[model samples]
Target: MGNWSMFTWCFCFAVTLIILIVELGGLQARFPLSWRNFPITYACYAALFCLSASIIYPTTYVQFLSHGRSRDHAIAATTFSCIACLAYATEVAWTRARPGEITGYMATVPGLLKVLETFVACVIFAFISNPYLYQHQPALEWCVAVYSICFILAAVAILLNLGDCTNMLPIPFPSFLSGLALLSVLFYATALVIWPLYQFNEKYGGQPRRSMDVSCSNRHTYYVCAWDRRLAVAILTAINLLAYVADLVYSARLVFVRV
Candidate 1:
């Protein structure tokens, strides 16, 4: 979790510096990528990253530490992370395409949904750390593969749009995005159902609830019990599935309406 916090903070600092330099130096025209897409995309991910670190750090480490300078610093960091999260969220909202405004794809509804789908996948990846959770069964392992495959597709979509390389695609980008979103929805739906069943249903040698196993209950555990993390993954999978469904709807509309 400490490592997670460090990465988040460093990313925020670097992005802040870069944005300041680009804007102050009038370098937007020289940027290789679309200025509009880059900032909106960066803000989306930065908000999510800071939000994740803010939640994970306090839940994973701050509560376990004794009252000291370290704990105080941890608390301070979490607070700042939350503030950064809000700031970035505001940036996204303020710059997003309004009802009548023309803007980059990153500011549109489907694009925002893509950001959310990726972020939820990131959270699911964070929770599914225990190898024993999925390695024991081929079916459970398939669920892991589903998560990875869908995450990769969504990430690639985001990158393609970010780099303004969607024009290089064979089909219209909206059609491509709609197809990808539909595929992700199916993949996540399968994982959402399979993961919880394999992890919680007693019929599969799984716990029916949170386990009392020493490793799970011990403070040394990074986040939560294995069972709880399993539950978290299940929940995040569902959330991502929904986000993809919404993305599919919006992208399909774009293809049909040519908007």
Candidate 2:
């Protein structure tokens, strides 16, 4: 499991990055900017690009440069293939329902359903891409870098919300979007801070190791049995479930109001 985690991590991120790029390219014609729902749907591309290009690409580069081994690539590739299919489904739905009047608060629904897939990928990759976030870096440097990136991305997201862009305009949705963006950044940055401190703790080896296989209540997993890992896992899992729930609720609302 030395580089299996790192390899799988790189593979998943690469596949996701590829899928996102290809999907966006293909949708350029299908979901043109001239369409009324373009901005609404475009937010999905923004979020995925931020994660895959801005975040995942750098990590994959580091992983390959340092280890250059993709032992368990197939597993991670298969997982992302499923996510790619989900992404395609979202695109199909958008292609079928585009260029129409978005009744009530519905403009955000289709784009948001697609955006939810990216959020879910982030969580699912938490287990697959464990340790990559802080891989191949000194403790202080890792913390500082992640802190800076998360901070800057959060600020940018808030600024985007403040502008006349996306569904975060002219209503209560802006506040919700801002909170979501900041909270996401905070959670990601918090994990970075916690992992270093926890690794340096005198309890779990007292050294900053790459990865660990731990057991929690008979469930064996790759994350260390540390407070930071537990907290991050819980937060990511909660966010994933919440995003799915939001998608379902939005779909229901759109259908009910339309009916």
Candidate 3:
């Protein structure tokens, strides 16, 4: 599961580069999914993916290598990954909606926040994929379910907007977006509270002693422990909760102010 997160960024980077090249070459129409929303959505996600990789890879693996070609290669990869993260971030900011400009929903504030919400959920997924992180407790498993369900809903919202299918919904799209954002805020808040309490509270059979554990610092140990992953998930849940709150505010403003 540790290597899985690393692989994800590699795959995302490759696909994103292909998409960018296709759009730049004016061959975007060759693919059915290459609509206006696709590029922005991909860029936003790619930026976060690379940012996570640049931080995680070095922290997890770089210290294990000695002063040799392998360490140098790892450092070089980290540097390039950071540069890629910046490139993707610049692309998102460049394409974001400007004042009085008519653009797709993906270019708007709520839309960009959707990208952040989904990316944080992705990192949460990676952290929780190790069964030892949540398998012992049903409540912990429920937290995982919360993450998955919210991720699916947010992804669906993005796809519907990208496909211009929001018009097919029975409700006004703004109201729909606001409703989903509010629902996400509620769900994520529950996870934010539940995950930390269940993971760190001794009353809940939680660790409550991860700070005193020194096994992770051993040179031979490269993978993060269950305690570390649990803490990571807790922090990420809180982050996504705040993102949903911001998204909800923007969406609500779109409903009322635009009216």
Candidate 4:
């Protein structure tokens, strides 16, 4: 199951990366930002995200829920992914419709909102999965504490960035990128914390019973861990990171060209 989960995650990540590269690098590069191109781009993104989630949700339901684990984390992750897709679509539509409404620092508010939504989603997932860790005592305590702190920081950073944009606070590209980097780190960190719980289950619960049993009774366990759940998270993290990097590069170029 563990090996299968790892494989699933890798496959999903690879496919998503390819799609993103083609969309942002090839398609966006060739097409002007018009209503026609924007819808096409968004439609592709929506399709990919939904397809990936559909692959993930059933595994999550079968593996986690059937094992006395709550489906909250899986549900939260799915919800977040769905909302993230919608937010991206909205951003593309809004930007195409009102290209000149906001420029410079203020221009990033919509993207920042998307980031905020993602953060909220991550926190919800973390909280939902925390109980599994709590069964481990002191280690769980430390993990939960650290996760809470990071979530608070992420929330604060999002609010600060949004406020800066709203107030026209003269934020530079470096500052924006730094905020994004921090958020990315927090996201991956949260994933790291949550992953151990799944590992624990794979190790102790299910068929293993702490006997190093590699055999899985739940066929969906393999799909859940391997392809469906973790892969979605990995792809989402990659997409956020790529978009952040692109925004940073573009903003830096604008600044440099102006000077």
* Candidate whose lDDT is highest: 1
lDDT of 4 by residue, 64-155 (tens): 56443356665565566566556555654464425445332323443443344345446345334525424545544544454455445445
Candidate 2 runs further than 4 Å off: 1-43, 51-107, 129-230
Best by TM-score: 1
RMSD of 4: 13.2
Candidate 3 residues 1-259, lDDT tens each?
2374468567886887788788689886777673778888888888887888888778777766789998998888888889989998999999999878888899888999998988889878877877877888898888888999999999999989877788899999999999999889888888888888888888997777776455455534456766777888888888899899999999999889953
Clashing pairs in 4: 4-226, 5-225, 5-226, 8-226, 8-227
Q: What is the lDDT of candidate 3?
A: 0.83
List TM-score per model, in order. Answer: 0.93, 0.31, 0.88, 0.37
How many Å off is the CA of 134 in candidate 1?
0.9
Model 1, span 1-259: residue lDDT tens: 8898999999889988999999999999998888878888889889999988988899888888999999999899889999999999999999889986888898998888888887887778777767888999898999989988988998898889778899999988888988998888888788888888887888987787565455576656464778778878888887888888888888888888744
CA error at residue 37 for candidate 2, angstroms: 7.4
**TM-score ranking from best candidate downward:** 1, 3, 4, 2
Q: How accurate locally, in lDDT, is each candidate?
A: 0.85, 0.45, 0.83, 0.45
| Residue-level lDDT for 2 in candidate 3 | 34
Q: Please give the distance, in angstroms, between residue 75's alpha carbon in candidate 3 and its true position after superposition.
A: 1.7
Clashing pairs in 3: none
- Candidate 1 wrong stretches, greater than 4 Å: 212-214, 221-223
Please identify model 4 stretches exceeding 4 Å from their true place: 1-91, 96-120, 123-127, 133-151, 161-259
